[model samples]
Target chain A: MTAVPDPTAELPVAIAARPAPGLGALFLTCLKIGLLSFGGGLSGWLYQEFVARNRWISDEDFASSLAISQMLPGANVVNLVICMGDELRGLAGSVACVLGFLVGPFFAVIALSALFDSLPDVTMLEAASNGVAYAALGLLLVICLKGVQRATKFPPGLVVIAAVAIAVGLLKLPLIPLVLVIAPVSVALAWRRS
Target chain B: MRDDDLVTLIAVFVPFSLLSIGGGSAIIAGIQHESVAVHGWISSREFIDLFAISRAAPGPGTMLATLIGWKVAGWWGALAASLALFLPSSLLCYGVIKVSNAHKAKRWHKAMREGLAPVGVGLVIAGVISIFRLSGGGLVAAAIAVASAAILTWMPRFPTLGILVLGAATTSALYSLGD
Candidate 1:
């Protein structure tokens, strides 16, 4: 008779092999997220849909993926496609996710542009549009606050750098010069810590 | 849309897509340079109006390409230009992510993130400063920024859409009354 097997080693494989949602389902879900997200809620909405509502990845995994994406050199949404793709289906999965992400937003923007000329220039509509802009600013501010909170938990040196960068770079000095100074300092600090 | 216009559309969008970092707003100066200054696609006033529409509508601010495209060459131009604008960034992002994941635990990956933190902060700060400059140092503009920031922090419950609408309405009304 065979000895009883341990369950721990089987867990990751099981999670990995767990059947993915159907392609149609995945596409629809992504499209829905793309369509409904408004006034800068896309990132948070994505987090909710992918991590909270769906169980494709663990919370820690999702957070790390998000952080990595933010660090990368593209729009956060596209970066998300890469993260989700890797987690779900490797290279092929990444392509599919990226395609889905791009197609929906592209078509939606086209549709909106088509309607641009016909959109009423009335007072109420104008008012509503203005309101949306301010709301967008507020949404962006909230996102920045979250970023700050996350950064604060890192080394105190980082917090100091961020503060100085904001006060001196944002308020006083020009951008190009400020970046030239801060970039080297930040790199040096990271090198020392490492 | 003329074929030549399609070529111009691609020319404008390809570089813009590559350089439009931080967010869509960060690329506004570039857009202004292209549309208002270089190609003369639209007047400055019209550019401002388009900017308003892009922000007012839902979805990414990069969607401004569609409207500008539409203005340049009609529906087909809009479609072609929008695709060109987004495709490069999306493809580049996908490739980067793929490679990064392959060696995620490496020191270079960690260093990249550590290095980027300051850069990201700098870019955002630059964007905020740029917007401040565009507000022309007017008291009303300064008040709007401060008040908006305060309200957002203190009453986080209020929907952002609502705030934007109120500000726009107040501005429009004031403008209408010859302020």
Candidate 2:
């Protein structure tokens, strides 16, 4: 994971993908993510930064991290941050990333709550925030579409995706049990396709 | 500011943290149950208001824990609740990554990686649904979402912040004019 641009290394070797993000860069990147990410779709934003723009992690690594983070019990965004942070710079890197991610909203929520009583029109804010959430959903849908197209290449992948979406999204089934039932079949199919 | 209040906040959120499979939205109802019905930290009305507040603020909606903690006590309560809510699962995640990461370049790992990709897609779809539901199923919201999606699809380099601002501005203008 350490991809720091080494000065002494020969330039004739494989071209460096990008400079490895140091702890400070990780914190700032995550901090920017925390502040800028209004609504949800945070995973998409992280993908844009780490995979598309920065070349910090490959597309496949991001995909696998998404899988791991979603499977584990926590904030999907937070879990991804931890996984990528650890991969980037070990335990301390994870700490910086997590703290950077949480710190902005920690104070923002409290401060906003204090102002909650003072606002003249909560409904107006509601209208605006609803708009924000809606737009964020659009961004998320784009990523969802991309993920679907990629997953379809593997056999039975589209079937698993549709089944899980129906069960969890429409039926509102509890995630753990649904995943428990679906995961083994999904993994086995992927193995066969491989 | 009571010590017991801090302890209570911790006691309540720790369980929700681990139980929050799929993400923070998963345990929102549970958090509501405990905070409103069980602990009486806040009323149901306050819960709704804070939910909006957390949503509007620039972070995860789960930061409702911070608002509730602030309401229950003050800054210290907010700190306590935030820690309790975020820490346990984080440690568990850290441990899991540390262990599973021990093996790499294996065939099973590749299978796990490929298999999990669709699962995340399933999750993104579910999140889109739940959040749509949360917004009272507004057709206007649906239109705005579709518009923004199209915008991003074509101009992948378009600044997202601009989209969000435009969304807020458009809705706010429409609502005020309608009113």
Candidate 3:
């Protein structure tokens, strides 16, 4: 019989894979992710941290984890934190991850709320925000395109679904009705093909 | 507010946390149902406005929990609502991670990923469409979306805050001109 490839041997020797991060480091990383994650780059950042930077997980595993996070309830990023924490350090890690992720945003929101009075009247601030919104839309589009490229092996069906969905949405069709119509048809096609 | 009111607020948000499948936007319907239809905490117009603010805010859209909580029950309420919205799902996710690690490379895990990807794409597209709709159908809004998409594709190095500020300024300037 041919020798089976050793998975462990394939691991990068240059990158020392430590055990899960300590509570403080975990908290700090999560906080940084939270603060820096403007307009939702949280998933990409998580992939970089856990998979590319830390080498704690593989890309396939990260993709799968992200999938599960999206499927589950709560914010996808928060779910991912729990997933990563549990994988690394069990229960306490999970708690720490959640706390770390939420703390920065929570305080930031509270602080911003206090500044409600001046928010609308501040023209420069409004101008800055408008710029941010435009950039956010760009970031969001890139993320979506990347996601589409990754997920779709069958380009034809994928393009069709994307185009149809975009059309319906732009036409001002109600979301619920569109979902009800497209979801089942897509599932049926997938089922039949499988 | 009374203790019962606090409990009711928590009850509304807790289930919402669980049912929010896609993210903050996914829970909008549920939030509207509970806050407007059932409890009468906020009117439809107010709910819609709150959604706009949440989307425009610099942080997670779920920060609406804090806003609604503050409206309903002051500081304590805000804290409670935020926790309730986040904790259950966070714990559930932790549980999922534990189970997934134990069952890595299993067929079900792979299958679940395959199934979720399309659904997620659909959901996200739907969300974008809905946001566009909410911005109101106009050449200006369409131009904004198209121009934003093109600029982002070309020069992603541009800060997001800068883009949003520009959009708001353009809109405000146009509005002023119309007056």
Chain B vs. true chain B: TM-score per candidate: 0.65, 0.88, 0.72
State the lDDT of candidate 2 residue by residue for B1-179, as single tens digits. 89999999999999999988778878889999999999987889999989878877887778988889888989999999999989999999999988877775778777877777777778778878887887784888899888987876665567878878888898999989999
Higher-ranked by lDDT: 1 or 2: 2
lDDT of 2 at A151: 65
**Top of the candidates by TM-score:** 2
Chain B TM-score of model 1, please?
0.65
Preferred candidate (TM-score higher): 1 or 3: 3
- Which residue pairs show backbone clashes in model 1? A130-B164, A130-B165, A131-B164, A131-B165, A132-B165, A134-B164, A135-B160, A135-B164
Per residue, candidate 3 scores C-alpha lDDT tens digits across A1-194 of 78665444334323555576788888887887676555444564565466545677544345445546766789877887787787777788778877888887777666666675346776555444544444345444544554565556655447545754575556655444554565555545544455
What is candidate 1's lDDT per residue for B89-165, written digit by digit as tens? 76777777767668878876655556555455434444445545554535554555456656655554444445555
Q: What share of the true interface contacts does each candidate keep?
A: 0.25, 0.69, 0.36
Please compute DockQ, using alpha carbons, for every candidate against the native two-chain complex.
0.22, 0.54, 0.27
Per-model TM-score on C-alpha atoms: 0.64, 0.89, 0.67
- Clash pairs of candidate 2? none
Residue-level lDDT of model 1, residues A1-194, one tens digit each, is: 78555443223311343366665556666666566555444554454456434557543344445544544445656676667776677767776666665566666665655566577755656544443343344444443454454456556435644654466546665444455565566556666667
**For model 2, how many clashes?**
0
Ranking by TM-score: 2, 3, 1
Worst 10 residues of 1 chain B by lDDT: B118-127
Q: Is candidate 1 or candidate 3 better by lDDT?
A: 3
